[model samples]
Target chain A: MPETIAAVSPAGLAPEAEVYTRAFARVAVERTDHEPSRIGTLRKAAIDRFGELGFPNRKLEEWRSTDVRAIATTTFSFEPSAELVSEADCARFRYDNTHELVFVNGAFRSDLSRLQELPDGVIISSLEQGWREHPELIEPHLGRHAKFDNHAFVALNTALHENGVFVFFPRNAVVETPIHILHLGRGGDSPVASFPRNLFVAEENSQGRIIEQFATAGDTDTGGNHFTCPVTEVVLAQNAVVDHYKLQRESTDAFHMATFQIYLGRSSNFSSHSISWGGGLVRNDVNAVLGGEGCEATLNGLYMVGGTQLVDNHMRVDHVAPHCDSHELFKGVLEGHARAVFNGRIFVHKGAQKTDAKQTNRNLLLSPTALVHSNPQLEIFADDVRCTHGSTVGRLDELGIFYLRSRGIGEEAARSLLTYAFCADIVQRIKDKSVRRDLEEFLFRRLPQGDVVRQAV
Target chain B: MSLLEIKNLHVGVKDAKILKGVDLTVNRGEVHAIMGPNGSGKSTLALVLAGRDTYEITEGEILYKGEDLLEVAPEERAREGLFLAFQYPVEIPGVSNVYFLKAALNAIRKHRGQEELDAMDFLTYVREKMALVKMDETLLNRPVNEGFSGGEKKRNEIFHMAVLDPVLAVLDETDSGLDIDALKIVADGVNSLRSEERAFIIITHYQRLLNYIVPDVVHVLLDGKIVRTGGKELALELEEKGYSWLEGEVHEEAVAHA
Candidate 1:
């Protein structure tokens, strides 16, 4: 494979110098290979903005609690993977009921994917194809969900993404089966970087679910530097419904940052769930804008981290229209010396009367060294809204643990069961059964022993 | 030989004595009922026996199957054939009842050098046990004790006991919220598990349960200690006269002895 990450470098960005240097080189090579077009201009603008800002430091507002100094120093490279993932690797990330769209190292891997029957009026294809055939569809929604100037990672993702899946469900057409997207990043012995972008549009009265997963291609514990910056946008028309799930399980040396923007039309229902189990420095920026009247939005997340890994989930539910309701729940289980950040905010606009918004963030630190920073904020401009927000950080209830152990469950098993149960509330919200099962299994097998020291102790 | 023996066992929680100088013994094939009003330490003894860490064993020894029970952790005590049916079984929202029961059973079986049961075998075994308790099949598939009615939760507890096949089962107020019909079903489930090598300490507040699952020995606990011991008929007596009468009698006896 032609090395792109080594060709380009960024000079003198003190805090994010290392990550910028690595990302700049990788972005240069990947962008060079892409067919330039009108959409490419917008993506390029995002990249330039990112280059100017670099990765956010502690000085940034949204990144205060989540510092990515480690990401800045990591020696990683990007470009596409040279190795081919065998059929066995494909089987490792399969979902039973849904059609799989596999992207290896940010490029769509056709050999590893199975695209099945689609209902009429439903458009499903790679982002590269969408750019050429349906340029109008990708123009308005791309980079529209995230703020380019404020988010360095968001800008970086827009600038360098080579290929991703694009899904469009036309008016009144409901796709019962979920659309599954698997993004596998294999760093191997050297640095690897990928920018995976996904855009989903549900027209009026349309309903669907999108399940996206990111992980390393094969099972090796090599701590090579890697970064996956992903951007996903969900646009719902009047009375539309969209359920989205993002699963991030990368190598420990990998840096993952994703922005999920959801737009709800009049009377629409949108739900977004994210489970973070891997990544060295992971940050997820999720925003749901209830644009139409009587729209409903639900944001749920569960993050399980161990080792020295840092996982952060930031959520904002903007209640723009009256008679809208939005609920956000985020829970975390931190073991070892792992640290997690949960910041959930609910914003009720002035004219958005009768808005009902609720937000809750709960953290269970199993080890004393396990650190969790939970911040729940509510900004209400209207007086006639019922808005409540709560943030709690504590260890698992001793009484609950004792109750489980008294019933014959071993201590370790009891702890595991309780932690799973704590996160299961959010996992069950996933409408897709196979996706939920896959997540449950991943959380069980890989979550046990990873961190250096127990954080909750 | 006694299946469970607690001699001069004293336990407390957060420096407050809950089980003070309590002495009890239950032989195999016998049912012992510990009846007391709320705050009388009947539940504390059960928790202490189950090796719950909340109740610190300040001074005393608990011998179960001739082993120092207090020295064992809660899970170890469970592996040693000990089970506690919680008065309010925790509602684990994501863990199905069958999964939790199978895990408990497997842990006990592995402790006893028995092979683990795979999915098919566990389903069959648990289905049969669930039928014994007349529990709804839906409850077994749902998360452990979650969304269960009062009686359903109690019956699920007994079903777990039936699966674990513990040598000593401690039912902490298992009959507290059950109707007569549900109580009969739970009593029958416990009766079927009774064997020559197993014993039960059924904790309850009312004598109505003792009517269905007749106890060989009845112990009256008050103020963190077993103040009086009697036959099964004593439950009927206490039910009629009320525990206040027993407290008066114990106080009189203590004064006279002093």
Candidate 2:
């Protein structure tokens, strides 16, 4: 790569995107990874779209509260690595009984990954191997759910994605245990950006759980100065039941932009938990479409941030058919100059009657300096639908604190206890016992008087 | 020494003054009743005594156990055996009632240089206090005061008063929203907790609560000042005859002074 290509913004694109444009051309010529020919056309279109849309600015209504100048201007390597960087200690985050898939620096590590004996009709492997072995299986649903026509980050991720995870469950396969994906971002001497992608396809009547945990190696507090752009697409066939959880615990200084696109068929019950507790500048776009009748979609998110961190969650639920239901509950807590934004919209398409949809977004500011912009919008084109949306932004309940303090608890303990209670609204909704327990343990460590909170709740 | 003393106490919120030039004294084992009309600062006095930060004490001093009570923090005040039964108990979701009381009790005990109670021991101790208020066992595991009926919130306040065992417990309009049956039950809860080592400063808008638990002294507060003081019969007189008569006498006194 020439130094001139990295220094200047090429043809009005951002300098950050310019580096990727030059790097993409080189990677495209010398690529050795295996994928279907359809992906090649998808990547070309995505790169062209990336050149056009560069990066989002505050002028856009969706990106007003969140500023992306640092992500657009900073130069990070788009490297493809075969050697493992850090020791990637992931023992503390493991669930008791489940298959594990490991990805280090956006590159799949088969030596570090594990899988149990699969029941028939279940497929789990790296997308690289999955495409190499069975391109037919990867062709139909590869870029189906999440298209990058309008989203720049999605386009950028689509153009430069490394081998991520590929999961397939044939019709009527009921697996008891969850599949855990641990993506670790380790700090090197210089900053690097990685685009990690995952594709999940479940056939009719299948039931299972999936957990995605993105974290820094060793859980260190500093030197995570990297960028991760990940896009995940999930397709659930009719009558498929799936519970998904995404825990984003990147390093405190890491930049993370993620997009989750999910589509549901008739009578499919899908629930997702999105938890973001770490990262410097983080933005997540979670979009779910109930495209078939009698589909139920539940989306719950919790974002707890402090210390000048900024987290933004953009959610959209589209009821595309009659008798479809969607429920969304998103909560955030911020302190110490931290800022958070929650923009949730429930769209009821024409003739989508009996489209029972509910959306709630609440934010708690622990410090006066912290701020939040909660926008919950509803767009209904149907005449007879039950759709409601509400949002609230407030500090910890002062009167409640006064009541607790008057009863002999210290003011600090009371505040921590109340904050825990506020977060429990979404935490308790997680159906998996092991996942919920790990989340509780992770949350308790961050709050003071942890023992009291452990006992009180 | 007196259990609590307030000399020429002047309290205010913002620029509006409340509890103007109020002086009072209470000894151990004495139950003093403060009866007043609406906006007469009965609730204000209770909150100020409990060290609520919303109120500013611009004049005079408060002494408890011969120490400056106003100098202590709210939690420190609670640990030093000061309790105020809130007029409107707060509903705190996700904090169970049993766990909240245990935490409160443990904090106070730690301040007294005593060891913390284990879960079983705390449960046993709290059950005894709950029985005094006739509280249902089901309410123990529910979030603190959340979705509680008006009567239940009042009983929970007294239940807390019994468990914390404060040296000076101020009941701030605890009988305002209770029915006749709930009022008697609350009064009985207060009566059972009375002893020689503790005192009660019961503030009420009506004297009906005084019938169940007779006060050692009754004081009528009007327009931010205690205008009259008497024995238990004063409550009876005010119950039969309304506060308008007392307001008349206060107006005459003010005119004479002017």
Which candidate ranks first by DockQ, i.e. highest? 2
| Cα shift from native, residue B20, model 1 (Å) | 3.5
Give TM per candidate: 0.87, 0.95
At residue A40, candidate 1 shows an lDDT of 58
Error of 1 at A160 (Å): 3.7
Error of 2 at A155 (Å): 1.2
C-alpha lDDT of all candidate models, in order: 0.80, 0.86
True contacts kept of 2: 0.69
Off by over 4 Å in 2: A1-14, A28-33, A80-88
- Per-residue error for A413 in candidate 2, Å, reads 1.4
| All models, RMSD in angstroms | 5.4, 3.2
